[model samples]
Target: MRKKLKEKISEALSSVLPITVIVLLLSFTLAPMPIGTLLLFLLGAAMLIVGMGFFSLGADMAMMPIGEQMGRKLGGRWKLIAVAVICFLIGAMVTIAEPDLQVLARQVPAVPDAVIILAVAAGVGVFLVVSMLRTRFNLPLGPTLIALYTGVFLLSIFVPNAFLAVAFDSGGVTTGPITVPFLMALGTGMASIKGRDEDNFGMVALCSVGPILAVMLLGLCYQSTEVSYTPFAIPSVFDSQDVGAQFLQGLPDYMKEVALGLLPIILFFAVFQLASIRLKRRAVIKIIVGIGYTYVGLVLFLTGANIGFMPAGYYLGTTLAALPQYWMLVPIGMVVGYFIVAAEPAVHVLNRQVEDVTSGAIPQKAIGLALSIGVAVSIGLAMLRVCLGIPIYYLLVPGYAVALLLTRCVPRIFTAIAFDSGGVASGPMTATFLLPLTMGACEALGRDILTDAFGVVAMVAMTPLITIQLLGLIYQRKIRRTRDVTQAEEREIEFVDEIIDYNEEVEL
Candidate 1:
């Protein structure tokens, strides 16, 4: 257990440190923020690292094992019903806990935070069950995604434009740090029971569709009012002490928010431990400790992104964007996007899970490369939208269409991980930094901010679908060629065996 803790802590730090370096460089070179703000940002980054370390450790200790164990035990009388109920609850709990969603929920006008959280949670629940069902009966991943997305597109025709981007953003945001690790492990663990490799891969893919439909339906329900929210600018104060104090005061609110978010998952796990599976007491205790880490990490993560990082990002973009050379938006935004995706707490968990799920055949580095490219493209496209004042649908519709089409060509598991990547990639950093930066750029360029600036998150969410699926297609083709070579070898061996047998018979 001690070794496990050390390893987890080391991994989290390693993951976050690179991003912190980039942030520091950005602060000094690009933003050149005040000393007070820089100090606050560094403090926030430290908290984020510590929080993430504890959180990932806790998740390893509790969430992944518990999910796998429960999934493995889900057999016998009323198992189907039982699995469905558990899936729904897990989906709801994790989605509610998503930090990115909480960020977006706060920004959304005329909607209670709870309302948006619940709506997104419910969406995740419904889709998770569908994912489980796909596992139970070998449903082809491509057709299912195509059908579901086709339905979503048809619905998009009448949905309010204001809600469209927000709705899609909800889909991506709901699958955050706590949710991604747990869901991927749960799906893989559940697949283990069937003893089928193909069954394991598509759970992430299938579950992604749930939020899209849910949010689109949500768009239909909430009459689209034009988004009127303008982000609050971070005031540049000379006093470092005051900046520290303001951050500390704001920290507790996020602590409370994350505490509430984690409660449902903990309670559900507890109930599962006692009533149904009856695991040993020691294991349960370990999981409980893990839950503590997850909660602490989540609280700190939110505080850093919102209080420290967000304002810095907004101010930086506003400053750089105001320059006469509007093209500065493209390169700076792209560089930031490249490093920023690595900072997202969920991306670490996602990459690790993908490697584990594929047994190193799909390397974490590969996943990172794919993500970097996708994010780069998304950032570029987002800047274009901001510059041209283009409607998000024009980009989103085509991107998703290509992504969904690729799902058919790629392997089943890749499809799941790819879709899941979409959600994982568009996490807190995207919201706090990328969104604000794009917004600032748009405001500077004199473009329509709502229609243009608002959909960067959506774009961030969409591009991964294409890149990961492209990865999947490449993997599938490789797998096929390998199989062909193996088959040829087997045939040659069989021919040799037959010749030997004939000679022995003739000699006899």
Candidate 2:
């Protein structure tokens, strides 16, 4: 256990260190920030590394096991209605507790936070059930995504133009850290039924869709009021004590939120344990310890991200954006975007699972690179939207059109992983940092904040669908060229070789 934690932390440090360096370089060169802000960011970066380490270990120990066990139990003898109800409850519960969703909710003014939360939660709940049912019935994922996404686009027509970005972003943030491991495990467990585990990759993708549809419908109903934005305050620190105090003051709020965020899943696991799938005592204790690690890690992570990185991202966006060469935001943002995806907690979870599911056929580094390229392109495009007022639909309609079209072209697993990657990639990092970064630039440029600033997460989510599918296309062609011969083919070739050998020997 200690060795694994060390490895996890080391991996996290390497992943996080680059972004820290990038932020520092920008601060010193292009976007000088206040001393206090830099100090806070440094502190946040440190905490994020430690927190990611703990959280990764904890997820392996706790969340993954609980989800798998629950899934296995559900795969047996449960009625379809019962399964649906359970899925809905779990989906809504985890989503309501997602800190990323809460952060996103606090930023939007189109609806009350409670309304947005409930609406998005309900959306996730319904789609989670759909995901499981599809797995149970052995349905093809491609056409389903095409049909659902088509419906989502049709619903967008009814949504007001100004509020469209928020609707799409809801889909991205719904599968944040708290939701990813569990929902993914649940999907794996569902797919494990009868050993038909080939199609376990699309639960997060389907769940991601629910929130967009839900939020779009909400946008139409709530369009009567103009959307509003409240600027997040930058901290003031004059001394070391003030830096310590800032962290001290911020700790309790995140502690409460993280605690609340984890409670539902923990409690559900407890109930499920008491009722069914009761494991050995040692296993339960290990899970409890993992849960502890998860809680502490999350609290620290949220504090660092919101208190530290948030201000830095906002400051950079505002400062650099005011320059005459504001379009430079594209390259700088792309550079930042490359490493930022590595820092996303849920993204780590997704990459690790993909490697495990594919049995090392798809290495972590490959998926990481594909995701990095996708996010880099996304950041560049998002900056373009910020620099010039591009409509969200201009990018989204064609992006989804291409993504859905690629589903027919790639292997089913790649399509699943690609769609799921879109959601996982737009996690806390995108919500807390990139969203603020783009919005800050948009605000500085005097563009409409709602239209320009709001769609960065949607952009972040969209590109991976294409990039990963492209990777799959490459993998498919490579395999076709170098496929392993079947036993019959090998035997026939050997027989021909033996016949040649016999003729040669007899002639000699």
Candidate 3:
């Protein structure tokens, strides 16, 4: 347990530290924020990172195994009821736990957080059950997604303009680190009963569609006020003492905040531990220790991000855009997107699970490459959106069209992983680091952050759906070619044997 906890803390620090250094350099060199503000940002970043680490630990030690076991054990007699209940509970738990949802809720003036959270959670639960049914009966994921998303778009037309972006964002944000691993595991376990890889892997994609429709429907149901955001103001950092004091002062606040966020997830895990997993007392104790490490790691990460990294990111974007070499923004943005996705803790679990389910046929390297390309394109497009002040709808419409079309062509398993990939790829780092960086750049460029910066997460979530499905198509074609060659070889061997037998008989 101690070792596991240490590892989580180590991972959190290592992943977060590079961004912190980058932020510090940018803070001092570019925006030169006040020392107080710089420290606050650093503190927040640490807490965010540490919180993620602990949350991930809890998910693994408790949530994931429990979900998988539940899926595996549920009998045919109760499959429907078991699936519906689990999906609804997991979806609701995840939606409620999502920090991003909370952020979006605050942005919407008319819809209360409780209302939006419950509504979105309900949407996820319903869709999740639908997904489970699709896998159970061998339903095609592509057509189902197309039909569902069509409804989402139609409803989007009626939703208040103010709620459009936030609504879209809600879809992406609901599939965060804690929610993703457990949900994917649950889907895989459910799919495994059928012993079909395609069925197992595609559940994430189907589940992802549910939130988009849910949030869009929400937009129509709630008439939100026009959205607005204040850019992060540069802080003055004159000396080391100022940075130290700022971090010191903000530490307790973040500690409390992260603890609050982690409690529910932990409690959920505990309930599962007592009721489901039934690990020995010693094993449970070890898991408890792992949870503690996770907590420490999260605190460190969040504090670092909010205090040191975020301000620096904002300043860097502001300064870079201020440069005569504006094109520099694209390359830098792409690079950050590429690395940031790798650092999203949930991504590790996703990649590993993909590899395991595919028997190493779908290498983690492939998923990484696909995710990188998707993120790069998303960021590049986001920068363009910021520069042009283009409506997000222009890009999203084409993007979803391409994604949905690919869903039909790709193998079913790929579709599931791909859709889930979109959500996993856009996890916490994108929110804390990439969003702020883009927002700062947009601010410096005099662009509307709401129209531009706000949509990066949605874009990040969309592109993976297309890219991974493309990979799936390639895999499908390869399988066909291999099968054809094998058949031809067998025929040739049979023909040769007949000729040899006839020739030997004539000689005799």
Number of clashes recorded per candidate? 3, 0, 46
Q: Write the per-residue lDDT of candidate 1 for residues 1-508, one digit (tens) a residue.
A: 6676677667767766776777677667756777766776777777777777777777777778876776666522446887788788778777776665666676556566687668777888888888888777767777887888888889989887877777676666667666777776777677887776666555555566676676667666767564565556775656777887877789888888778767766777677777877778887777878888788878887788777777677766676777677676777677777767877777877787777767899999999988988998899888877766778999988998999878767777777777778878887778777887787787778776767887788789889889988888888888899999999999999999999999999999
TM-score on alpha carbons, each prediction: 0.89, 0.95, 0.86
Instruction: Give lDDT per model, in order.
Output: 0.75, 0.88, 0.73
Query: Cα deviation of 96 in candidate 1 (Å)?
Result: 4.0
Q: What ranking of all candidate models by TM-score puts the best one first?
A: 2, 1, 3
123-173 per-residue lDDT for model 2 (tens digits): 999999999888888898999999999999998887877667877888887
RMSD of 2: 2.2
| Model 3 superposed RMSD (Cα) | 3.6
Query: Model 3, 142-196: lDDT tens per residue?
Result: 7887888887778877876666777677677777655677677777777768888
Give the clashing residue pairs of candidate 1, or none: 58-290, 201-413, 205-416
* Best of the candidates, TM-score: 2
- Candidate 2 structure, TM-score to reference: 0.95
Using alpha carbons, what is the TM-score of model 3?
0.86
